[model samples]
Target: MTEVVHYALVIAHAIESLPLSRAKRQLLSKITDLDIAGRINGFGGCIAKNKTLGEEVGLAETTV
Candidate 1:
């Protein structure tokens, strides 16, 4: 449950960090959807990967 919330925040932050452009918005939505599913299914190391992705996109680091 905590991990789900953490990943949700990371996804939200990633979406918020994107430019306010339609194309980027759509892309972010799709990307986050997939990421969330993958994380929920225990596929990708989503928490760490999302943190890295957020940093790469200039979002501040957040505690999980």
Candidate 2:
């Protein structure tokens, strides 16, 4: 449970760091739909890849 919350905060912190426009922010904010448990389950599946994607675009670690 604590791990879930930890990753959620990490995710939320990551989302908050994005350099997004209002339209982009709307899309990013939808990430809230993917909560702590969701992240714990899905983190290894795609989250790591997501970090790589952000890197490709010059985004920082927390930007994803």
Candidate 3:
């Protein structure tokens, strides 16, 4: 979920020339189920990195 939010924000920012509502609608229209599944798979890597950083900083463990 966080990765999706991050991707959406980055995509929206990249198209900042467009109006906010249009940009969001356009971005959402382009997304497909496969795209979301791929991102969800990739989120494991993000979680692993976050866990490593948390360990280094002596923070509690987290999970997706």
Candidate 4:
């Protein structure tokens, strides 16, 4: 589960670094967020609830 979250974060960071349009970036971001949230929930945790991207990433990193 931790590895899954880490992988999702890595993918999210990669997406963020791409020179994409704002709309496309946001679409990818939301998709990544859903993936991460689902992974965390499957792990019997809910760290992503109401958290900002930075906050969620921080939690994911620490958990990993």
**Residue-level lDDT for 43 in candidate 4:** 48
lDDT per residue for candidate 2 within 1-64, as digits (tens), equals 3553334445346666888675456445444544444566755323334465455445555655
Q: Write the per-residue lDDT of candidate 1 for residues 1-64, one digit (tens) a residue.
A: 3544334335346676766675456545655776777776766733445466545545544521
Write one digit per residue (lDDT tens) for candidate 4, span 1-64.
3553333344427787999876567655765667677665664323444345435344332322
Candidate 3 has a TM-score of 0.21
Model 1 scores worst on lDDT over the 10 consecutive residues at: 3-12
Q: Residue 28 in model 1: shift from native, Å?
A: 1.0
For candidate 3, what is the lDDT?
0.41
Report the candidate with higher TM-score, 1 versus 2. 1
As a whole number from 0 to 100, the lDDT of residue 64 in candidate 2 is 58
**Where does candidate 2 clash, by residue pair?**
none
Off by over 4 Å in 3: 1-48
**Whose TM-score is higher: candidate 3's or candidate 4's?**
4
Candidate with top lDDT is 1
Per-residue lDDT of candidate 3, residues 1-64 (tens digit): 3533424123434444555575343443333333444465654223334454445445444620
User: Order the candidates by TM-score, highest first — what do you get?
Assistant: 4, 1, 2, 3
